[model samples]
Target: MPKTIDDLSTPCLLIEKERLEANCRQMQARARAEGVALRPHTKTHKMLSLAALQKSHGARGITVAKVGEAEVFAAAGFDDICIAYTVVGAEKSARIAALAPGISFCIDSLEGARQASAVFAGLGRTVRVLLEIDAGYGRCGRTWDDPSLVTFARHVADLPGLALGGILTHEGNAYQPHQAATVMAEARDRMLSVAVRLGDAGLATRGRFVISVGSTPSANVFRNAHRDGFSITEIRPGNYVFNDLTQVNLGVCSFKQCALTVLTTVVSQHRGAGGAVRFFLDAGRKVLTSDRAPLSDTYGQLLYHARTMAPHPHARLTNLSEEHGWGAVRGGSTLTVGDRVRIVPNHACVVVNTQDEAYLVDGDEVLNTWRVDARGHVQ
Candidate 1:
């Protein structure tokens, strides 16, 4: 059966099979060259098929952001999994602990470590834990030079049902294209310094890939670090699987490297009294998402035709209603109502979660549809 994007419904996800495979292979090659383990963050697509594709490309393990995602991947036989987010509280801890000793996750404080100790002890399974260090992201973890870091490490080492693995960081501020190298190199040095301090304090870190960092923008930082004699053992780049506008704006990946897109249609069109052209697309904030790339005001980049695969330079997605994407072009569009278009969304990670399944395409020819196995696994 020959399938095409036209046969599929509007406001749905589409992943280019060839581009995705190339993205995975390129990241895998970088990891191999750096001699670091590639544990790609599966939070981007959250599908069994996508994670399996990454694992096939030499991903030693997988990195997920939630306990539910961890459970989903673990049940699918992903033996080595790490919940990149800190799993705290009795409910969260028990759910995550059940996946151990095959699972590992992050922790930032002695309090979370203390909580994990009680929960995992009751579950009777030892879990590996990495202490998170803040590298300018400020969303989680302590600063690298914080005195509580060693205290937290000592507790993780001594706590029952927990083994101190090593240190981790998410240098999210390193997303700047021009400054990523400096920012991430400095972050790597700080993380390594903390690792040295933990060792000097006599804490036995058992995990093999201990000094880890995540962020697609900082992917090459890991490579450079490893090449320059820094001991970073793992990288967890998630959005590299389906690079989005943000990856392109941040200069991490080129525009052509982006694989995921939304197939939409021009449901309605209007011409203002002053002769301005307007278009209302079937996809809205719900599908394309409101996540805009840096300096790019639009929600998603528009393509005139899926078969053409050429980005429309002038047409701008101005606003998004719940079910309508309002766009405008300075000059009149040759497009009319019912014209199909594909959009390269600003954030592939959040956008994929909006769909139950995504059509796999190889240059407009739909090959298959894969379930988003871990979608909505935000627990």
Candidate 2:
């Protein structure tokens, strides 16, 4: 076993194994109690081992954002996978076809459906697809109440080598600056109304139709939505496995539930002309990331130490350069040049993608090292 954080290099990513497992259990239990399937999004961790752990905790399947990411997980033996983004182009569709027979993906427009259908047809297989409904998040997908939805459904039904499996949506607006419960309710009601409307169109009578909705901030609303008997088939939350400062700010999770942090060391310290102490860390926009939570302007929060994973509160990450983070000491924090600190980034998903590997830790003891095999698979 690796000894301590000293054995690892500076600015390394660390995953608190116990906290991660606990997070998985909590999400799984919540989904089960509400009688909904948890098909967690794997784009957060991008690690096969952790995805397997989620499966072990009763996830129905895994969700990825790209065909490249799906290939990585499928090669690692994850059979049921859903690409939650719109897939277009011949090359991407071909790559997606190779992973077929157990793959499903999202379709937001008729042209995408035609392209996917044509490509999969040439490969001699039918591809299952879920129509993406824009439930007022306004990012991607056709509007839920669009009169053209039935026309698109009819077109998809008549297309060769393309099967309309169900409807899917992401209530991403929940991450916006709003009361967590309020956004949750809006997300639940909007998506449920659309799902019910679509299900009544005779498509759901085929037994393959499903209504899926997810986003970590609105996960509880999904549970309550399901408990309210709206026939929500699956919940696809990704970041619940590693809560971040954003989730903490949204009240989706507490700091104790966050499972990942940047193990950074203080490399330099100096006082301004006004006699205020400022320290720079080895972690910066490259690792800790500059994703600011709407609730806080700080890039990240510095942890007290290994004995206490609690945020120091006094040491605020005020600014970030390419390879350095400037932290300000307030409330009488006496940080020194050689002090070691853990930083809980504003967003964990993008932070994990910045590194090639992460150290799995249980307290200060390094349990093992896992490669972030899909780090740059953004294509």
User: TM-score for every candidate vs. truth?
Assistant: 0.95, 0.95
| TM-score, candidate number 1 | 0.95
Per-residue lDDT of 353 in model 2: 93
Candidate 1, residues 1-379, lDDT tens digits: the string is 4388878888788898999999999999989988778999999989999898898889989999999998998898998998888777877888876674678888987778889889987777788888888977787987898877777677788999888887788888877657777777888788777877776687744345388887888886564443223378888889999999888888787778989988898898988668888989999988887887887888888876777767888888989988999988866787788898888998999889989999999987899999999998887
Q: Candidate 2 residues 49-133, lDDT tens each?
A: 8888899999998999998899999888888999999887778888988874789999987888889889988878898899898
Give each model's whole-structure lDDT. Answer: 0.84, 0.84
Cα lDDT for residue 370, candidate 2: 84
Residue range with the least summed lDDT across 10 consecutive positions in model 1: 221-230
Superposition error at 55 for model 2 (Å): 0.8
